[model samples]
Target: MGAYISTFPTGFAGLIPTALQKLLPGAQVVQVYDGLVHYRYGGKPGDLGKVFLFHNTFLVLREFQGPASQMDSMVRSAAGIKSLPPSRGSFRVRYSVKNQFVAVPKERTRQLEGKIAALTHAKVDRVSPDTEYWFLQRSEGVGFFCRLLGRRQATERDLHPGELRPELAYLMASLAKLGRDSVVLDPFAGYGAIPKQVLGYFPYAMVLVSDLDRDRAVDLRASLGGKRGVSVAQRDALTLEGIPGATVDAIITDPPWGYYEEIEDIQVFYRGMFASFRRVLKPRGQVVLLSARKREAEAAAQEMGFPLRQRYDTLVNGKKAAVYLLEVGPAL
Candidate 1:
C-alpha cells in the first residue's frame, strides 16, 4: 500500500473522508484536515485520477513534523528517497501553505527546484512540466512532501460561469445514494453537469434532464441525446410538465441561485421547485440539491414538507453554497 493525500475545496473537506471511503472501496482513510485527506491504498495509483472529488491527488513521498526552520532539510531529505524513480523529461516544484495555493519567491522557488532537479536528474520546466512535486505545509510543524498524480488537463466543456464543476457534480450525484436501477431526474439541468456525471459514473435505469432555456435544451439534446435511457427536454422546473407523479427515484440538480436569473422572491422559487420535486419523487425518494441561498431553501423546503436529512455547507466558485439532502416525507 502507498500513502497519498488529496486536496479538495475548503468547505467540502468534511465530506471527502466519507466520500473517499465510499468511492475507493479498499482505501483506508488516515486523516482529514482543512481541504485535504490523507489515505493509504493498495489499488492502482492511476485510479486516483478518475476520482472526481479531489482537486489534486498526490503520492506522499515523505512527511515532516518539527519546527519550521528544518523545512529545507526536510525537502532535501524527501528528494533523496532511493525508491523515487528519476524523472523522464521535465519537472517542477510547487508550494502550498495552510491549504491555500500561493506563489513562492523566485529565489526561494529556484532553490527548492534545484534540490528536486538533483534528485530526479531532470531539467526544470516551470511552465507545463512533465512532473510536479508539491510541498504542502499544513501548519508550523506539519508538512507533507508529495508528487502530484495525473495533473488536470483542461477540456472544452470545463466549468463556466453558472456551471458546476464536474468534481462537485460527482459529489452531489453520490449524495443521492443511487442504485443501478434508479430513475434519476434533473429538472434544472443547466448545461447538464449533474446528469452528465450520473451518466458517466453511476449506472441508472433512466435519466431525465430539462432546461428552461430553449437554446440550452437544444444543445443538451444534441449532446446528450441518442444515449440509451436518456431524455432531454425544454420545460419549466416548477411544473416538470410531462413527467408522471412519484416515478423518479432521485432528483439531483444545481438550481438557480438568483445570480444570472431574476428571482424576486427566493422562497417563492424554492417552494414551487420543491412542490414539483415532491410530486415527481417517490415516497422517501431523495433530492440532492445545491443552493447558495440556504436559509431560504431550508425554509421553503420545510414548508413544503420535505425532510432535510443532511446539509453540507460548501463553496461554488468562491460563493457560499450548501448541498442539501432532502426526502419526500410528512410535513415538518
Candidate 2:
C-alpha cells in the first residue's frame, strides 16, 4: 500500500474519506485538511468521482513557514523522487492554502511554478495541470504533496447549467453501497449527471433516467447511448410512470432547487417526488437526493412514510444544500 491524497469541495470534507472507505473497504483514511484525505492503499485513483485529484504521495511535509522557502524545499523534495529528473520535464503544481490564509500571497503560484522549472531544470508545461506537486496548509504548518494530480473536471462529459459536481455524485453513489447488477433510477435527470456517475462507478443491472424537458430527454439518451441495460425517457420527476414498484434497487437523483430551476411550487414538487420515490423503489432500496429544500424534503418524507437513513448538510458553490439518503420500508 502507498500513501495518497484526494481532494473534495469545501462543504464536502467527509466525502473523500467515505468514498475511499467504500471503494476499498477496511482501508485506513485520515483527513489532513479542509478537503483532503490521506489513505494507505494499493488502489489506483480510478472509481473516484468526487475525488478531484490524487497522487502517489511522494513526500509528506509537516510544516511550511512561507511560500518562497517552502517552494525551495518542495523543489528539493521533487529532486529526490526517482523519476522526476531530466530538468525541463513538463509538470504542474497545486498550492491549497488554508481558508484563514486566503490572502497570503498573490505571486505564490507563479513563484512556485518558476522554482520547479529552475530546480528540476525541467521545462514547465502546464497544459495538463497534472499536479506534479501539491502544497497544503495543515494545522501544524504548510506541507507539500510532492507527487500529486490536480483539477480533474472532465470526468463528466455532459455539462449543464447546474450539473452535479463529480465529488458529490461519487459520494452519493458510494453512500448507496450498492452491489453488482443493482437497478438504479434518476428522476430529475439533468444532463444525466447523476445517472452517468452511478453507471460510471457501479456495475448495475439497469439504469433508468427521465427528465421533464424534451431536450434533456434527447441529451440523456445520447449520454447513456450504447451502455448496456439503460433506459431514457421524457417525463416529470414527480410522476415516474410505468416504472414497476418494488423493482428498482435505488433512486439517485438531483432535484431542481429554487436557485437554478424555476419551479412554481417547491414544496409541492418535493412532496410529489417523495411519493414517486416511495412507489418505484423496492424494499431496502435507497434514494440519494441533492437539494437545498431540506424542510420541504424532510416534511414530504415524513408524510410519505419513507425512512430517512442519513442527511449531509453541505454547500454547492457557497449556497446551502444537502444530500438526503433515504430507504424504502423493509419487506415483511
Candidate 3:
C-alpha cells in the first residue's frame, strides 16, 4: 500500500474520506484536515484521478512534524525518499505554505535539487519537469513531502463568469444520492456544469438541462445534446416550462446569487423557484444546490416546506458558499 494526499475545497473535507472509500473499496482514511485528506490504498495510485472532489493528488514520500529548521533533514532521512524510482528526465520542486501556493525560495529549491541529484543522478528542469515535487508546510509545523501524481489537462471549453468548478459540481451531484434509473435536472444550467458532472460520475437514466438565456441554451445543446439521454432547453427555471409535475428525481443547480443579475428579493425569487421544484419533483424527491445567499435560501426552502436534510459550507472561487440538500416534505 502507498500513502496518498489529496487537496479539496475548504469546508468539504469531511466528504473526501467517503468519496475515496467509494472510489477504492480498501482505502483507509488516515487523516482529514480543512482542505486536505490523507489515505492509504492498495490499488494503482494513478486510478485516484477518478475522484472528482480532489483538485490535486500526490504520493506522500514523507510526513513530519517539528520546527521549520528540521524540514531538510526530514526529507533526506525519510525512508520513502530513499527509493529513487526512475524518472523520465528532469525534476522540479514547489512549495505550499499555510495552504497558500508560493514560489519556492531559490536557496531552498537549489538545495532540494542537489539532494535529488545526489540520490537519483537526475538533472533539474524548473520550467517543465517530467517529475515535480511539492513540499507543503502547515501552520503548526507539520510538513508533507509529496510527488505530484496526475496533472489536470486543459479542456476546450472556456470558463464563463461565476462558473462553478467541476470539482464542486461533482460534489453537489453526489449529494443528490440518485439511483441508476433516476432522472436528474439542472434548472439553471449555465454551461451545464452540474448536469455534465451528473452525467459523467453519477448513475442516471436521463438528464435535463435548461437556461433562461437563448445563447447559453444553444451552447448547451451544441455541447451536450449529442450525448445519449440528454435534453437541453431554453426556458425559465422558475416556471420549468414543459416538464410535468412529480417527474424529476432530483434538482441540482447553482442558482443566481444576485451578483451578475439583480434579484430584488432573493426570498421571493426562491419562493417562485421552490414552487416549480415542488410541482416537478417526485414525492420525497431531493434538491441539492449551491448558494451564497444562505439565509434567504434556507428561509425560503423552509417557508415552502422543503425540510433541509444536510448542508455543507464551502468556498467557490474564494467566495463563501454552501451546498444544501433539501427534501420534499408535507408542505411541498
Candidate 4:
C-alpha cells in the first residue's frame, strides 16, 4: 500500500520523517517531490486524526503545461531532496486541464476525476466510487496520486491567543505524531496549540499544558474543555516541577526564539529549560523543539546530556524555522 506525506516549506519537511518514523515506523519512504512524498505501507493507512495518530502530509497534485519528466527533474533539484529515498517504480499518475487562475475550480476537479477513470481502465461512472486518487496542489501546478483517500477537515482560520499561525499548530501535531494512548506535554504552551493538536488525535491521553501567561492558560482551558484529558496551569518555564515526576511521554514545543530579544538572556533560558525537561520527562520520552537559534538549543541539550537526534528547516510565518528532535542521554 502507498501513503502520501505533505510538508510546509523548509523545516516542514523534517516534521514528515519524524511523524513517519513514529506512525509508519518500518515503512519505506518510496518517493518524494516538492510538497509531496509517498510511503510504502503493508497495512491500511492509520487514522491520522483519530485512532492511529500521524502527521497530516498533504497529497498535492499540480497541473503543468510541460511534461511530467520536466516537473520531476525540477523538483529533484530543490534543496531538501536529500531527505527522501530514491524513486524507482511505475505508479499511476493523474492530471486535469482547466483555467489555472481561480482556486480549486469544480470544472477542473471533475475533469481530473475523469482522468483517474481513464488511467485505471474503469468507466466514468465508477470514478466517484474509486477509493484511489489523492489530490494536492500549489500555486503553479496540480498533481494526483492513485491511492486510498481520506479527507481532512478544512483548516480553521480563527487563531487562538498567542498562536503565531495555523501552520505552527500543524507542525506541532505532525511532530508529536499524537495518537491514541500517546501522552503529550507542552511546557511553553502558548494558547495551547501544541497540546490542542495532540489531544485532537489522542483524546484519552492526558495532556499537560502550562504557560507563564495566566490569561492564555485560561484561554487554553476554555478552548479544550471536554475534548481531551487536559490539565492546564499558570507557571513559568523555570518553575515547572509542580507537575509530577516522569509524567510526560513526548514534548512538542516552540519555545520563544528571542527574535525580538524579549528573552533577555538566551543562555539562561536554555539552561533552565534543559533542567526542567530532564526532570519531568520519562527515560524514553522525546522532545521536538522548533527554534531559530539552533546552536543555542544544540549546546544546551549537549550540556544536559540530551542527544540531538535530527534537525530540519521550514518556514514558519514566512520566517525560517529550525526543528530539532532530542532524546535523553546516550540511548538513541
Per-residue lDDT of candidate 1, residues 135-246 (tens digit): 8888746788788886455433565657778888888898888898899999888888998899988889999989999988998999898888999999999999999998
- What RMSD value applies to candidate 3? 3.2
* C-alpha lDDT of candidate 2 relative to the true structure: 0.67
Location of the lowest summed lDDT over 10 successive residues in candidate 2: 54-63
User: What C-alpha lDDT do the candidate models reach, one value each?
Assistant: 0.83, 0.67, 0.83, 0.58
Candidate 4 per-residue lDDT over residues 1-332, each given as its tens digit: 44455433444544555555555556667554443455655555453333122324433232223343233322322212223222222222232223122234455545554444444444443334434333333334434332434443333345543365544565655655545676677878887767766665344377778888888778877876556477787777776857776777787887888876488877678878978887777886788888877788889888888888777776665566778888877432
Q: Write down the TM-score of every candidate.
A: 0.85, 0.72, 0.85, 0.59
Clash count in backbone of candidate 2: 9
Q: Name the candidate, 2 or 3, with the larger TM-score value.
A: 3
Against the true structure, candidate 4 has what lDDT? 0.58
Better of 3 and 4 by lDDT: 3
**Which of candidates 2 and 3 reaches a greater lDDT?**
3
> Ten residues in a row with the worst lDDT in model 3?
68-77
**RMSD for each of the candidates:** 3.2, 5.5, 3.2, 10.2
Off by over 4 Å in 1: 13-26, 43-45, 66-83, 101-112, 125-128, 139-141, 155-157
Residue 284 error for model 1, in Å?
1.6
lDDT by residue (191-263, candidate 3, tens digit) is: 8889888888789998999999899899999999999889999999889989999999999999998876888
